[model samples]
Target: MTDVQELSDWAPDWLQAITPQNRAGLQVPDQVEDSRLQTPLSQLSQSNHDRDDELKPPKITNITVMPSPNRMVKRKLQGIHLFMITVNGTLGIGLYWRGGQILELAGPLAALLAFLLVGLLSWAVMQCITEMLCIWPIPGALSVYVSEFVDVELGIAVGIAYWFSYSVGFGALIATLAAEFDFWTGTSGDKGIDGGIVYLLIPVILIAVNALDIEIYGLLEVVTGCLKVACLLAIGGVLIAVNVGAGKQGYIGTQYWASPKVYDRDAANDWGTAFLMCLSVAIYAYMGVEIVAASALESAPSARWTRKTSDERESQLAQTPNDSLIGNTVRFSAKYISLLATISYSLSGLLVSFDIPWYHCHLPRLSWVDSTANIDCSDVSDSIPANTTSAIVAIAVESGIPHLADVVNVFLVFTCLSCASTNLYVASRVLFGLTSRLDGGKGQPWHLRLLSWFGRTNRYRVPLRAMIFSAASFIWVPFLQLQGGTSSSTSIGMFIEILAQMSSVAVVIVWTCQVLAFIRYYHCIKRHKNVLEQQKIPQLSRDNVEDYSYRSHAQPVLAYVALAGCLFVLVVANGAYLWKGFHKFPFLSSYLFIVVFVAMWILLKVARGARWRHVDLSNPDKVVRKLRKLHDIRLAAS
Candidate 1:
């Protein structure tokens, strides 16, 4: 008989064949049986796993835990998609329509100062967001970070308020779109086409665009974003040319700014009050700049998915603690986009002032009866309102270029459509994030279970239910138009203005929450650092503390500044009611979102039976420690 050692030297196929045939007689070798029995199960299992692993594909981790709707969403968005989404969101109908109104209310200097101040605040808020997102990229993470770092009740309130803001903003854009159609057809009187038809059609278009794969939506945004950027740059250049004597008007210079009457007080009847009011308009222009942070889950690096083992993931994370793809993109986009937007806003205000004097700009009185009637600002009327026309188009028309005005009107229509689509996207994602926290645990309330249904994804991994619900906000457009009489352009414009006021307030509140959350997060890090120092552990380096993937300048100081700015805007913007005698329209539109936020917080707190003492700050702090441990392990491994 051949010895087992001699059989091992032969081919395995031949050995198997011989062993099976000679099994009963071959088992006389006790040495071979004892060697097999002595083999460890772990070694045998590992060998078998190795053979099986070679045939299997790599495993990809989901963005969220199992059963989460976010888990179903594919990370298809790249850095460019994120950039375009943000630009598309930030640069919209607000700048095109409200630019002239802001200048009319507050002169060129005040408008410029308001925009610059708000731009700085926005930049600071974005820095806080970038720091948090780099460490944990999650969809709709704004509310999540607030919830973890602050009170859960406050988080729920912020989420609901944000969702409301975007939803209402979507409806406002739809109204703007309908109004634009009226502008194109030159129909505004009793003989005008039904605005309701256009309102219905706009929502349908938004739903169609949002229902497609995320990649397709992203690509669409890229096209629109490029067009918007080009359009703005062209408008700026044309405005410059017109100011420098390109048009028949000839070299206007800063004649408008030089006039003292142009800086007359606004509705509040005070120059300081008028300047404070412009802050809200400026904030509205930059409302959606933070969408880049919201898109972090989809734009995070693909390196996270390719790790072969847990150890490998930890090692890689430690080696590059600040190597987030989304973080880098956000940092780049936030810095340059904020700067560009500030310049665009200030330059547009300056040029528009030069192109058309404040007195000549038509500020429409927002009334249900004949809303198109212009409020004469020659006397600096008590009711200063937004312009009933696009400032860009107005500038072109004033330049003796009717054809250019037509071109600009077309661009404005497209801008409204693009912004409405983006608003729906944001609203739906916020709803998804809000519902995802329910977890469908046993004994959940009926309302929570109903909301959780919207958290589910369809075949394409899109939140179809949530999106459809969000799109329902457009229904308000038709209702407002047909309120008392026939639908008119003025009514639609009024609706848009009301929604903008509400949305602006919501934006300020959201920013305030984010700034406060960041302050808490900063303190959390400090506590961890203190503990490390006390224990004599190697303290985190200064680079680790300050310069992560994106460095937010001035630490807690910038955060405090942002916080103070947001609170100031929140109070002063709505304070008009004190002097205006609390008129229903202006008062409700400005303070309605604030009321809703407080009510929602109280309701949530009651439902959860939550107390201030029970708030948890440790979880977010633990995240910091976990990353540090990985860094330490990597050092040891190397």
Candidate 2:
């Protein structure tokens, strides 16, 4: 065997946490933390990944041996699949009820404006994440990127916060289902299927669908996305036809805009409340846009689908599907999804402000959340609460065509079902990937080892246990909402708000960290570049200044701008409730989500203890280990 000094000499720069001066007695840990997902939480302490040989794949438990080869996740996703995934991922709440919030807070014009501006800023945020994904090409991307580019603890913090957000967001979506169920009972000849039955059925169906096969999951997204695209087109066409006297409204275009007010005209706070609050609601609408990054590592490119040819061979030589091809596909997926978001939200802005009357413009049940707002459109038709189901039903009732509303309500159910399934899928993978990072072979703590089991994939290559655990986490919230009844919506209203509040906080923080992580990533690369130049050593034969495949050009600047813009919106978005004094709760309620996120982060730190203190980059004794594979990609691509 070679001496330790010889081993140290051959280590990749990114993998070198020990310097030559102290190489004599140094004992490097033999745990490779490099993979698409990087290392687990336990592996982060000795943040330097062990060599590849040290990272032999963990033996799969043959407790229940299966016929097929065991893999954590089947890499079956393709371009169209990823494109559909992005579409479903980004356009969740926006498709159903978010239009009403925008229309209510900022009116039609401002709502449309809110979507465009926010979408642009959000896209900027995506650019940062895309850059990271291009370089890293890893699973559990957000946490892995944050750990390597920023701080490992911060990565764990982001993972936890994101998990909480997705969990609560799932509940928020489920809570609204009750309002949609109202449409059927009120209009469908009293089928006798109450909201409770719908609630119970949704989770079971989703779990079965998610656990069966990933191909089914991809197929589900494609079918649902096509239907959603069709629905959006139909809704837009309806808006156009009705405005042009196809309906009795007779050239109704912009008439409602003029009457109910073009903007909310919250003239008090310099009209900022109208725009800012709408921006806040708009944030939720576009919340899932960045999901492309989360799933990119698993997204299979066109090369995976087709048989190779002579022409394609040259392209393959230049780029493999894993890096450039996959990166391009991911970028394309994000683009199409963002484009869809912009079109849908803008069209909805026009359609909702015109169709759903000003008075009926309450929260859009989310397409049924706050039933108190549905008082007008209730079974008795006494109070009309502001929601998509209620507003459309109210319009249909006014037009003496109640059946149409039933169809729309049914359609909204499908929409929410698709969105909820996606959320559950995201939640399970993120939580599983987070826990997987802590896997420390057989020598780890009992608790750590026990939790690691939850991350294991079953026969279908699905994190079956993690999926069930995630399903169970927020499953109870909606049940409570069902029990609260729509009479006053007393319990449901507060509960949804709390969930939304927490979700808003956690998601925003996670997003902000992504932007900040990019900045740190740029600095890390620049530092490495400077050191290589100073030492008169070429890092790679083909490494020029433009070596990075997808550099975040003018990086820290764009990152800073995106970061500031998102943060400002986050502050105003949550606190807008208390801004006008026409609010329901206290300042504490608005900021409660942030408090919860910090609490979760601190608890995680306490759980981790002080083993990782040396990982603090600023410390003099800190051991630095950059991602080695990331360097290989830059060299190969360049």
Candidate 3:
């Protein structure tokens, strides 16, 4: 058996107090005597109460405390809501389109390899986030962590970069959403959709979602997330199955790579450009993992339910008093295993790249002049497969399953729209954080503004002004569309990809911090005896290595691999691209955007009356204490 199993087996019935039943009652301790406190911070209190102590009621005082109406309603979001928010944030436009671009560079084999490699790296980053979340479990996980573990400048830099990336990415998603719908419905006519109507809709819905209580939005995300994931899984499965059933060399199994030009390095005289293009695609796939970190805020407040269930199981095992200790150990081990199982479901999704799909093909060799003669070949022009990936998938579906186009189209549109909605919401939040009100005091220049709009509270505590600003940001897309040139669109995509990729670079930095934090947390866990004076540390009496903190084996291995992998991609692939100036126009522009915004964030820090004295490291407990008080005040008002 494993240590986790053993711990689950031995866990005592008394541990039920840690479950979600009383999560609202949770309070943070005033201080930590030593650094290694193992218990859930929520259960800790400044004054230790005996196990059998009776609950005490609060005393009324003579203070004139006028009750305030509930300023905001707290709608309990279902688990599905959490799921949609996560899925929508993570699975977006790239899944449907970018696969073809990657396929063009590396062939099918290389494309699959890219997905696999990025997926594993993403999981490592997520685990780091998981550890931090377990420790602090606050809203705005990245911003909070950056401010806490790293320098304020690093945090501000990352935050601004991230917000910009999300905003631009949101615009891209809206465009893609319009494209998907256009492909399905054959309705490209303008109410404003293809840069006109569709772009306008993005921020309106975003504002509406934000204006409502967050839980409502969360619920919608979970529902849509389920639909999106289910649709994609069905598509991937049916596509592969249909290919197999058709008895056509449907699986292909790297046939795309049989052509030497597909993988041959010498074929690419423009190696710098080729590699930059590949990095650009890979970064698109990697962008969503940060969404996972963004979601820590929405997890259930306490593990008390887990504790309660564990204790009940332990009590049953203890019925045979003669076997009390032995049976209890077994039960405790089981509890931990079950908790791990719950976490494992999310991990599976994190690991497997159930990403968007695209089309791939090869055309007969032709010169530029020959291509001009064969104008129809424009769809698949650039020396790679060029059919409309979306249309191809839809056609394949319609052909394979008779009259299935309607079903496929609906699924496709839903997936696109849900993802678009999610992108818009996240962008709004990012914009709220970035656009400061301090510099713009009541109406400053556009360049000087930062989050001033978001500071304006609404009935539900939503940032109405910020939402408007975010909506305004999307208007840039129509201007791009009004130009109406393929070259211009391509340039726009590349520019968005560059900024998004740089933000991804910032994500890597954030992930590195999280990995370090998780490693530190594991060390803290290893010192469990010192952390938990109330309970004896369980003995590891098993040889099975899988039962311990998988973090012990898996996390260390992944950390080194990911660090080395990121370094190579950034310094070698991306660095070479920058050095060679192949895509320097957009490349330099992206860096400039990042640098200017980072400077803005730093300047705002000075302008906002921020001081080093406010930079206190009171530990996670202190932060939780403040949050608990806030929660209490909210409850009292309600």
Candidate 4:
């Protein structure tokens, strides 16, 4: 503080002595390169500096108070709960109607094969997501993963594709409920419930259920999940019992193949039409398999309080209020459970298919009080139009135990309601995630708006704006069926099935991304290992990095296999539609899946002002940041 303080005190004179008076007097350090040092700040002019300063964030005013702690919003969910909610969502649409259609398209043998193969692929997608959840438990689950692993543009593309595909569920369910309401009330012909009570009720009911605290929703899901599991089991058990009791007469394996003449072996029943119908059926059967990802948001909130002991990071992940242990367990359990639901639904379809003469004139709707109960299904001669799954229950009830059929119908209605609830939740959350301005602390623009509308201290946080958006988004589906004429009996059903199948295809793509992420993670670990080995350092204490590394490496292979399987299903299921007499069929809906996917991606890219140059990974500026992060060994992106 002696000499230095004296110099500092007399800085007015000392600065003049040390400072350069002009360009000629300036003396820069030798270490500074000409490219950098030659660029004098004063010489550059004020406009350049002004521009640079403008690019930076504005400083916060001293008068502004720090933001309040994110209002202690709901925390992250556990792995299990996340898993279960996902399973319930995924299995919802697929089990209800797709199986019977698959049986008709691929034959019993082929349909079963399709289910197993697709299920494997679906599982792969689920596992990849599982690994992702472990690594990054955020609300924008897939979108976040894709952004980090692939380029941000690609991530945004995938997110948009996924969101659009998911929106179909909300739309499809409204249509489905309308169809059900029409059937029960006998107004499906024309001026039916399509534009009536069901459409309005769907949104209102969905909002009511979703607006509750997440824990209440979880409890409801658990109860519904259990019932869904029981329903599938009961359906399977009853079918098996009946088939066994029917003995040889109950089994008609190649009936469709043998009776081509009766069902029409003509131009109308050619491979193309048959294939289109088959694909239409198959698509509908497996539509809702991606619902798992949708459930991730709510699951975290439900298991918010549960605690677990693990890696500090993992424990941190677990205790994140929304990312609790219970949620994780539910998510994982749901994946396997979805497979069970698929198999049960498939078996029930198989049992019913034996009774229907696929190649002949429509099979009798079971004999008892019967002849008048006969549905004039001439318009829908290709497939069972009015509630296909319910049709099977009708046949069984008409033929065997009528009482049990009545009981099953209640459960069937329960399944539809559960599905609608799940879809609404998904729709709202998707809207929330997509519209949310995440750069604004933990809260979004919509979140604050919700807080204002719902009250600040409310435990139940509902994005009312998003819910309204979802409600509006689905309004057209029910009414759209009115334009189809008499053929419209199956038109709404067909539209729903078509869209649902496309969503499944989109899920396959998302699943593929998960696998790719797994592969990248594996390579990252491998690179890290090789670097450690080359250094040849002394023995050091280690974390379970290797275990995680091993898991990351192993899981992707399964994911790849699943990806291949999904592609094969899309090909086989839709192959007949595309390859055989392409124009003769309703290829628009089938093609619409890919069309929407690409169009949405392009629109998102355009909206973001992203171009090929922006996505270019070769740009040095873009890569240098990553290289610096790797070499400098800084904290990871939280």
Candidate 5:
């Protein structure tokens, strides 16, 4: 008899019933099964019977008893770690440099408005993510949700694009670090140590940190995240002090905003166009905020629930309060971090606008511009060394606080390092998620079979291969400095801008997919409400149906709003090329990801002959039934 037939003969009914075709009914979608699917009871029974003849347990038997390879990412992150990472992931070098870029692109008020608008979109995206996370709480939750609820092709596309975005962002961080180091050491092109050397070292350090236990990474993020918050606060205080005549230029209140030249008339003719153009920059600033959801795979509760036997999991659930679940923590963290990010970004824009004239930073300065009331355009020189100093540092210098500029530069280095590490961590996990599957299973498409190599983990339970690959991919970004040119600073600035724009586009696309996925999930839940109610799932029970604990407020309305916002930003922010007459480089950088995304979707569709699985109303209860089983198990265990 075939092995499958033989196994089925002695397998328990539960084991016999489990198959890929019907896994959706069991509430275990193929993607979730990729991580937590246990070995069939029959396999264990057969292994034990066969091993009885051996004097000791065979090595293979021990391997069989271990958790699946995909579940190996250690869950060491606690509630505090999640909260801090959520905050820190989005808080990075962008905050340091992006303010000046946006203020230069759009005037102060337009920049402030853009930050607020994107913040609302971020809120909606996080709400959708948190709600879905409460239900699945799986590793690589973002792409997995897209794949499960939406379609596999789109999920693959989003996963790859998101991973690419982080990878590219990591490169951008490295470039920023080199720029900061140049500023700190008073070095530039054809000068002191090569920036490329610094680039090489940063990634090595980040890889080492990520390679350690996840808890250590979490702790590091918490510390750096706190430092980042403190840095922002200090900068804010300094800005306020400078605005009130503490600096060389006294009583600088609203001087810049009141100037007719405050807005960049060259960039955009109208305030509205300027606002639209800067949306991508604002979105880039908020890119990493949703990483908390990505890190949910390693969360303590999620880990505990996934690793336990059904009975053990049930017992634990019986004792644990529902509110204490990872879902609640994720929801709280999302809300807290989004609010914090918005306020911080808006205030930074507003404060910077007060101290420095938008016209002052209109042209990128290679070296610090000194504060002088009578400074003329003729005094501007192109010979200053290129530095990665923020507009805030320029403000400090212009305020006669040169020492404060140095301190801010130091903090900027740390911020870049912290953010680079987070990017690597997220990218590796996303790549790992993309390649995860059952051992020896043919579930993944042939094109992706080679990537399965990165799916494995070492004894530390980290996806070491994937981590190494991700770090290595961005190593070339810093080498751009090696290219000899008179306008090296301008080159670096343009490179960073291109990366930011492309990454921002990728972020919006991912957000759009996520919001759409949530919409589908929302509808699926509604269609299956009766099944869910009958199953007595607390979150969806008859009494609690309308007031689901983890449900995001405003339901479908907020989701649609988020969707519309993402689409608007994706099209409008990148469409500047269309109006300005397409420059080859800008046009490519702006919409290249979209072209890549569409191409990928088509390739996968053609390769796999897959079709978009429209809302499967017929099996609407599949997800609901799965939730019911999970709830029932938890109750029984309790």
Candidate 6:
């Protein structure tokens, strides 16, 4: 027997945590009490969690995941809400928190341009993801495609890289909350006492929100997304207005940019090093974009659950799952994944460059408690270099807005909260999608069966159990981070590399993995076309190349450029860390990025056997073909 079956008690009751209790009967239609599915709510209210355990589904030891298809009348979240997913994912704390760092790395002008460059590159990368997703629309976008179209072992590595990246990111998010409070009060609160409270609340809130139904998640994101966009717009407008002599500090236009050192390098020789480090910092600021592709399965209809196959029902599944909501969601997913973040980030960068000087910063100190004093940047020698947090504070102070900096700090706090929630949301879903396919259709091993326990979703279809399991990292890792709480030696801060220069490595790795997967996907398509032409075979009656939804505008060109750009960023992102000498960083900090990435890949390879499992190029996945058939009849009739 394989190791999975031999250890029956390994993480027992893990899958059972879905909606209190889960079992065989949970798969039965009548047993599933999806309150949102049965009828539309007249007045939307928060999902009540108290009654989730009332239904007693019969227990079974074995794991069996069924396809969940939506019938015509049952769903929340029109395409409009699809934008919420991507917006929430991309508009993270990085843009608001890193202004100070950007100013310090390079002058505001170069940093602004660098940030804009990263946005463009990020959009390019998302385009590649969009091309794959529009074709597949499967859960766990990159990993699923890589596993199905590329190789199983390689796919697993990519998926873990993604999972681990986001897992560490949760700590990064928590670390920021303390900083947010510090900025808000203009004084660092008692680290041990107050930090303890946030550590307790952050995970509980995320779990509570994510554990509920999809509608609740969608609603929360929509509201939060709107507020975040508003905040960005208001701040951007204020910054622009102030630059034109509208503030206490008069007529600042481009003066900061033309100041003594537009760039941070001392010598021409070190210019190369400074530029690359700045570029990496800019790129790392745009992490958390994968939520769009990661949540694609949930945001759009994959039709895993459907009525029994019959002439009518089968025909229904084949014709593009005709609903305006799904149509709009699909369309919006493509547009919004990069649009909101790109515009906001670019504008924000320009504003920061205009308002803040490279050297002096008025950002709150770590132990500051004064609310009624002028911030003197000239005297402070050990001030935290201007990052996004300090940038906002500096801009507000310059604008002559009373307590505006504190208000913006509060907004930044919400930004972190929303980001960590999104991370937990996607992390849980990725783990669920992987374990759900443990008993793979055409490719898988015996040991995979053991992990199937992490695969199930709750009755509300929220991946509740999987989400809770993923939240285990929050219990200790973030708690340690809170202990340090903006002090000199923050907990888990070293591990995540947010304080260090390790931030962009994870983003680069994820982008490269997906682009590599895209290359394989491209090969599969051509290989299929070649086989069809040689065999003189007719296209399947319900199949249409056009039916798979949106085709990426540029085929391999977009993907290739994206891959090259990401690889370049990866090599250069760590230049700052390297300057201190590679030997200085042990295992815990930013340097662990490469080590963790390679080690995880090797470990997965050994577990899968000596060699990787290469997907058969001659035959693409059945699900891919099935999805293409969707809208086929619609296209035929048109």
Best by lDDT: 5
Worst 10 residues of 3 by lDDT: 1-10
Candidate numbers sorted by lDDT from highest down? 5, 1, 2, 6, 4, 3
- Candidate 4 lDDT, tens digit per residue, 1-638? 00111111201111222212222332222112211112233332356556474344433211111112221224334554444455456566456445544543444553454455455555566666655454343344566566655656666666656665666667776666554454344434435445555666656777787777776777777778777778767776766665555456555434543533221122124544443444334444454555555544444433222344556657665534222232343345434644654565556656655544342223321111122322344534332234334444544543465366556556666677777777676766665544342333244465445533321113454555565666566556666666652122254445655665566566656666656655554444444543333222111102354223113224446766765655554555555454434541246555666666668667767866876432333433333233222221100111
Q: Which stretches of candidate 5 lie above 4 Å from their native place?
A: 1-66, 69-71, 185-187, 190-192, 246-250, 259-262, 302-317, 320-324, 361-389, 438-449, 484-496, 536-549, 612-615, 621-638
Q: C-alpha displacement of 127 in model 1, angstroms?
A: 1.7
Question: On a 0 to 1 TM-score scale, where does candidate 6 land against the true structure?
Answer: 0.75
RMSD list, candidates in order: 12.4, 8.8, 11.3, 12.8, 9.1, 12.7
Report the lDDT of model 5 for residue 304. Answer: 29
Candidate number with the higher lDDT (3 or 6): 6
lDDT of 4 at 443: 43
Overall local distance difference test of candidate 6: 0.57
- What are the per-residue Cα lDDT tens digits for candidate 5 across 1-638? 10111221211122223333332222221112111232332333355567454344322211111235443577667778888887777888778677777776666785577788888889888888877766555656677778767887888889988998988888877776776776656554433344435667668878998898788888988898888888878888988988887444445558667743344555555766666767766788898878877777677653224577889878877754432365545666766688788888888888887776665632232111122332244533343334533677777665665477678778787888888888888888888766654233366545555676777788787888988998888778777765632233355556655765688788889999999998987877787777555333455532363335466789899999999988887777767534645455567667888998989988988987887565343563456444433443222111
* Stronger candidate by lDDT (5 vs 6): 5
Give model 4's TM-score versus the native structure: 0.68
Give each model's clash number.
0, 20, 39, 39, 3, 21
For candidate 3, lDDT tens digit of each residue in 136-204? 433344655565444455556666556556666666565555545554334333444555456675556
Better of 3 and 5 by TM-score: 5
Clashes by residue pair, model 1: none
Tens-place lDDT digits, model 2, residues 1-638: 12222222212222333343444432222332222122333344353355344356542211111112322466677777787877776776555566665665555676567788877777778778877665554456788777766666778888877877777777777766665775544422122243436567777888898897888788888999888778667656655544454246444546666744343433224346556766766777787877776666566544322467877876765545244455555656655566668777776776656665543533342212232432343423343323334334444434434365566666677777788888888888787767653543566789877776766688877888888888888888766654554322365666666676567667778889899887776665565554334322222112463334455445678899999987887676656655656444324445776776667666767787734432333321122234444433322221
Q: Which scores greater on lDDT, model 1 or model 4?
A: 1
Q: Positional deviation of 621 in candidate 3, in angstroms? A: 14
Give the range where candidate 6 is weakest over 10 consecutive residues by summed lDDT.
Answer: 1-10
lDDT of 1 by residue, 272-328 (tens): 666766676678888787777656655645343353688887676664433243345
Error of 2 at 202 (Å): 2.0
lDDT of 6 at 609: 76
As for TM-score, the candidate ahead, 3 or 4, is 4
